[model samples]
Target: MNNRDQKGFNANDNSNFNIGKVVQNFASPETRNNSETKLLNAVKNEVALRLAQSLHRRVYVELDKTEDPSQVASPWSMDVKLGDSPSQECPEGTHIVTIFDKKEIGGRLLILGAPGSGKTTLLLQLAEELVQRAEANAKAPVPVLLNLSAWKTQYSDIRSWMVVDLKQKYGVRKDIAEDWIETERILPLLDGLDELMSQRQETCVQALNDFLPDWTGTPLVVCSRFEEYQVYESNLGLNGSVIVQPLTDEQIETYLCRAKCDWLWEAICPDRDIMNPETGLARSPLFLSMLVLASDKLPPELWRQDKSAKERRRILFEAYINARLSCPYRGGENYQVGSKKSDRRQSKRKPVRNPYPKDERTKRWLGWFAARSVEDAQTELFIEKLQPYFLKTRPQEFVYGLVYGLVLGLVLGLVLGLVYGLVVGLFVGLVGEKSSNTVETIKISWRSTPRNFYKGIQTYIVYGLVIGLVYGLVIGLVVGLVIGLVIGLVIGLVVGLVLGLIGEEIDTKISDNQGIYQSVTNSIICGIVFIPFGVLILTALHYFHEPMQLSEILAQGAVKGFLLGASAGGLLSAIEHSALRITLWLFGYAPWNYSKFLRYCTDRGFLQRVGGGYRFVHALLRDHFAEHYDPS
Candidate 1:
């Protein structure tokens, strides 16, 4: 067959890949086109920024043909064209992009490497190039970097999961995300397959295999640790596989020299123990980079110590943490230590200060976070997603729930009454016991005509009636039954109508500061909407109920309405999350302001921001912290 046939498509051909054509026939073509352009630009910007953060200086690692592609790739000829082979061998130390372009591989590539061998870095490098290409050519597929570790068994289909990832990670609307997938405009670069549990790894491999048939012409790339991937019974259905090569001694020396780390190079070059094959510390780019960062703080004699690879790694990480913490801070003032105004005459640059919580406390908090993240099998940590499970002991959990419920109840009671407070408290306490495993972004938008307006009214009216009935029973025991029933019906109808008019739509998307702001705004709106209704109800009730003054009734009604409204909205959830966070802080597991702490860690090079969450700079670092975690 000709090269064009073998490769599945000509490099110059744009007919099959034109994204504009894909959405041209859809309704509101202009809107779709704009959304698509925005999505691609956002992806490019995010990928470029991530690449810059992970690798401060661009360092290309070499990739080579796997010794046995047949071992990891599907053997079934029907799944992939195994018979068709490349006319010439891919030379040693070939760039990943070049290998991806070859006819035989046809864009379906799998990358494998040993731990700390730069598998993720290589994948990001590939994504950077692909994103550039996509930006230049609309016909080219948009490259999206995702973590397979986040995949769950619930999503039996891989495409469905990708849709969710795009929506959550990139903030793409659900319909648009689905359209992008259906049109095959996305080039998925899935990383961290080995990060999944062993059993799930096999299942993910099978899922990828099943997903390939439907996505026959589209490109796909997956990364994993060679040792873990090789043991899996199932093989990925891909055109080809390549393993990331370890850094040669010469390459290591060149990198160190370029980094101006002559002392590190000198220490590593002469030491047989440090560069030994078993330890292979200098051979891995990640370790070498860590060594460079930690070199100044790391004592010279520590490198020559006789130690196992694991112990050596532990010591290296300790030094690395110290070095990062000790270094001058970089990035924007997202989490500044103090509010010091910058002088216009002093170059408008605030002087750098030491990071908060000190080095020892920072390490302990990170260790705790890493341990819990591993236990949950989570690669990304979201501030709002912190659960009761983060609390180590049962007593802690109980205290968190009780405090959370009690706080809400007391606030509501002070404003509304004892009955309202007790009911809200009981409800909130029950909800606190339930786990918050799902993370999502809720949006409240107004529609000209809500989809189920009548249904919503009916549902909310029922809720209002139930609450009103309880209030009526409580009031009736003290006051007359007629007065209680009349007041209850009016209050219930007004509250129900108000709620029914404002319909809320919850969308599952990733959010950070923006999400919190949105929730706060929602709470405020809910409080405002209920205040007037409350004032009118209380003013009318004063005639037949207790003989109260007009000003006193209005004051009491307004306060009660606002509190009840806020609590009924998202105020309860916000308070509950705070309770959980404070509980963790009391146990010294995390700081009070998690977002700031995480941002500080990102500034310190221990973590990197991914979408609305944070992930360790490398899985190896996460593993190190998890293994060495000391709760006490």
Candidate 2:
């Protein structure tokens, strides 16, 4: 086939090449390459819209078979309105002409929607109906629905994919004939084709043409992002489309009343909270399902929680994740409105993975898959995403950071304090020395004079302290205490922290950590070294005209510093203690663990990790928070 014939999708050619008995044998590089190029060019637009329109006809239902014990839904008679949310068939517009009939849809249908559109829920509901109908029929054949992402080849023939996927979905021991299955017109729905990562549009289209054909006309539905379809649809040559639109509150209300699920929204009730008289389900089908599931699973009496209107909406949304986890929680409930209890659930073989590997030549070939994953460990999950987070892990290194920072500040503070103290002290001493008649001790001994008594005492104290400095004890013990505490308290204060960071910056220029450490030492060392300044100040005061004794002034300083230092230490100590306690309590896990996670945060949270302690506590204490920590 030349480019012109290849221009349109060719399902026959691809079928001949891929036809083989062993599933493993058919999985080859050549076939994969050929298939991807064809699929990339396969028909788009109307194909997606048409499918979406078809699938939209089914009634929405619960994903889980068992009730999520934590959820609180509305009363049985209460008709919870879907309020503004999209429904199956009618998105935002009035009814239009039918493009296809039930006969065309048969037991299978597909609908492709944009990310925000309600494709998945609509598809699931349809799948449920098809499964039910097939089960009810004695002559019914197997009908399977699979996500296209599970497929390995980007350009894969849909028919071959069907046989293989059905084998996996049904645990078929023997391979089924592709022609035989097609002749009977059995259709298996596949969703999310835009999610496939192959760059070769031509190959993907060819794969589809060879795989899906008009002869059988089995309904195949797929959703594509609008942008993706525009770029890749030339080769497929297909049309008929439906676009999902935003729904009004009235629409949501109408759907919800019709849905008659375990949820309802109105002004208020004992079971459901008073939703914004205006707020309704709208925008997407996914969101509608989230609200229904959360409302149904959570206890009805509790659905009207203390959350802000926005917060309640967010809480309502957390059910999607519950829906996602429904796979593991299957029990004995039927989500389909008309489903019979006697109709047993089918468990398929292990799920299949259809990987579409990218080759290096195309611009998006090799790494495109990574780009599309959209969410992962580092990916931030918002309320919309339905992923939970544990907050306790955040402050894990708090103590290590705070203490290491403080110790360094102490050494630097000491050095700076010495220089500033010595310089200031000496200047005061020199100024006082200039004022004094002689530098030694400012006192004039007078015989029989009351004033002389004070002078004599002042001189004695100054002289005594000088001698103490020269000897073993510098300044009297009182002098030392006075100066030390004052210096210690100030050094430990917030000013020290600012200075330390500044010191670090200067260190960057000079690469001098010793200088940084020296400054920290000085902040604390200032208290010790500056004690002398305190004594000198007392001595200088004595030289002045109305001087007090040097000893009295020194005593005052020592007392203040000691008291201040003790208070400061206690504060810093408390900070450290609180940090550790909170870090353990809130983040990942610690003494308390996250015991309340499944219980406290159940429907209201998308908690991935433990609620971090402080943030978690804040959330708990927030006005709407209903529970308190027991710590029992």
Candidate 3:
């Protein structure tokens, strides 16, 4: 061994120069290649494992600082990747923050930013960490990976889905899943109302109103396209937010260099002048992976193969990863729940050459990959695939929703009517008494004139309002209690039975869909978005609960207090009715009724039968409940 032959480690060469020992370990070309391949595989494994770990760990979650709701949907981080030393010099206080510190005093993190701003990537990284934390705990090793995309449209009733689906599919007993998932307690995380609703003005503020109360026990992190979720950030009063910004050129270079492949560095380092060069776009994990693969094969000079860099890069990405997933609908089969009927997606795509011509049975494979491409022109109606409900029922969701809501509407009308009746009834009685000359009328006044009594023992306003309120409340409570209990029990029993038994079957026929969720969420967010405003409803039954017991009720009660009492139940019934109407409206959109309305004939005979037109239609009513529905 010559010391002159080794420039860096001559002493090590002198200690052992056994080239035979290093090279003669394998006898055959296959064995040697296998051994070399194993070494390469081990090296590759370490790099991927380390890089993936770093990608997750290096993610910063800055805590504290009040955020603008508008700022929330911006990149949750001004910069997602570790940037390079600025070419123009680093700005002070940039990339320095309390990101690693826990921001517990505030609400759950609401990661926001523009599309492609790295919010989802960063959150997935964070989720990886959370899942680890849960796994490390002595109990509950399996961490649930909730896809917000899937979650926004998952079984709306998660409890039933988990219990029923798990039992049927996984053979896991409902009891076990309930105890372990504590699903009801964690419903808040799965509540993606913000995502489900259209992200526009006042959306964030509205979403916050709906979301904050829904979350519990576990920490929550939401990722949304920046502009979309900014709607809620301000109203939520979140203590902290991080906006992800695009990586600078130098940052792009540093990442290129750190890829530690001479191939990658040379491939991406030279795009100094082009706007958003393919190399510069490599900040994204999706793009980053492409760079690694392209780097392995192409020279630095070859990366500039396309003249328009941005266009070239688009092609580059498409060439590698297919398309960026814009919706859960676009994602693969795993995202979907199994349909009872087999997916007819086969008839969907115009089958050309099978990507994997070797496998004749592509459809049968659950997660099979077939590279064949199916192209559709932009103007085709087949591009839109509707959920099963719209396909199965011609359009009955609205009808069901409307009928259910109308059925429940009687309750709302009764409540508001009682309030109207009680006040009106009392005012009439007070006025009657104050103006009366009868000795009997003197004690109990039915109608009274205004005598602004300030302990002169009763102003007409006070007396009338008080008496009417009291009588209204007493009668309303008795009526509501009797009616509500009977109605609720009967309706609930019938609905519950159907829902519990045939519900699994019927539920599939009705999907709340996005609009329904949004409507309910909107009403929730707006506070009055869910209120019923129509008035001048029938008030006949509200005057008294069968007038015979009315005197007995008023005789013992304080009119004012009792009216208020009656009003509470009425208000609840009203609120419930309003909520039901909103849901029904969602099911049976009014716009869809035009076709049926148009079918009506305007003939003289038809008019005669229908009571001469508009008045007849208004007066006549018919229920169209299904056989499953119990009128009681």
Candidate 4:
């Protein structure tokens, strides 16, 4: 064949190959649509399950004793008006879910209400309905409830925050959350716009506006307090808005009667004067719930007494808290909200914790915790994060720490001195002798600074106290204390001294501008080299003293020493870096356990458990505690 024909034939073959590759990778319109539908359905099911669980989790069976069993779970509803005539979608009073689901409403609605006026309850109800609809319709968007109190507008936009919220609250995979968000397959039922800082509220609203148009293809709803949202001169420009109406006196009377709380109904509205403004306190669902629970305990005439509304309300709430605390309550009920009659009422999960033991200690801890929550502007409080609030933050407190550390060390040294002192002293003597004779000075690194050495001492003391306490509890206090003290002192002194000696300035020739990773590697190597040798030396010295197999002694001692060294070394490295030290101090290794107390508060009505954390059942309750609590 001619050269030109051969070249043309080769080019043609390459072109055909490229086209075939494109065809293989490309998806047809139907295929893309089907794939999208499947992903949406999976998300819908996951969301439905979560919403149902959250909705039914808090069934006050005991509290419901006064009410009809059938109506226990029924949330109260009111007719809601949305916007003015022409552009108005939901002119007739409509529910939250209906406004969000109706195509004509375009799924963009704002719910504004007073504190504890049932905004959250309404949102939850909306979520429950959407969840059910999602199950029935494959094309429906999954509704996800998001708490906006944690949103930081300066750092992240609304869309980004939603992604994080999903992953955190629901344990949704980040990729899946992002995909769901990007595809607009998930509906965001945002709660607590008023929860954001007042100053940043405008910026948050603006960010919401910017984020909504292109990102979420489906409709979304936002909730805020009526007065808080009114602070701004302009509206949020949402499709429609509804103001949560105050409960009518008749409604309150009827509700109380239905709940079989005739006593409270008469107390608040004597002579069946339901419209009397004197019973204005019942307008809030929170206050009404409190009255329902506390009516039996409170004087029937307390509501009619000369006490001001504020004082009466305070007394009612205090009584309510006490009632919940005293009751033999279990956790919330967990049943599918929109299932068949037979299966709908099925209880799935038990209360998160057992009924709280009624006690003063629990109340005190909850009061302190509530105060901290208000200060931090955090509604959700995780148990692990509770340590920081209990931490002694005043700079003057370290003086106490130092004295405490010294006493601890001295006590530990005396106890452990019986066994480890001689061995450790002997090892130190040998090390000291070897160094004195050799030209090789003991090298120092950042991990061995005097400050860190002091810190290590403190850490060891705490560890010893914890171990000693545990042991003391398990065995007799005196014996357990002695044993734990010895173990803690031995580990702490051995590890602390080693780290302190090594933490000083090293010769320039040895450093080689070592980076953190390299330093860590070197520290690990040092631990691997020295720990076993030290352990072996100690074991040999004690071999005749303690009747044990030498090999077994060496093996166990070596393993323990190596672990101690590695832990000390890593801690030393963290201490050397300022940022890392602060981070560790603040988060990873803070020193208190308020878990038991937190659990107690959560089991009762004072707090609500949410994923790995606790939140005050309502913000108003938190404020009440914060203002009224005087722990001093």
Name the candidate that leads on TM-score: 1
RMSD, every candidate, angstroms: 8.2, 28.3, 25.8, 18.2
Off by over 4 Å in 2: 1-110, 128-142, 154-156, 177-179, 198-206, 214-217, 223-230, 235-239, 255-281, 291-632
Which residue pairs collide, candidate 4?
A: 57-332, 57-333, 331-351, 448-503
**340-390 per-residue lDDT for model 1 (tens digits):** 122121224454665573877888889988887787677777777777766
Q: What Cα-based lDDT does every candidate model obtain?
A: 0.67, 0.34, 0.30, 0.53
Q: In candidate 2, what residue range of length 10 has the lowest lDDT sum?
A: 503-512
lDDT for each residue of candidate 2 in 240-336, tens digit (9 for 90 to 100): 2334444445555655555555345452223223333233333344345345545544444335456565555455433433333333322211111
Which candidate, 2 or 3, has the higher TM-score?
A: 3
The clash count for each model shown is 0, 107, 45, 4
lDDT of 1 at 97: 90
Decreasing lDDT order of the candidates = 1, 4, 2, 3
Model 2 earns a TM-score of: 0.32
Tens-digit lDDT track of model 4 for 476-498: 34344444345444544555455
Report the Cα lDDT for candidate 3.
0.30
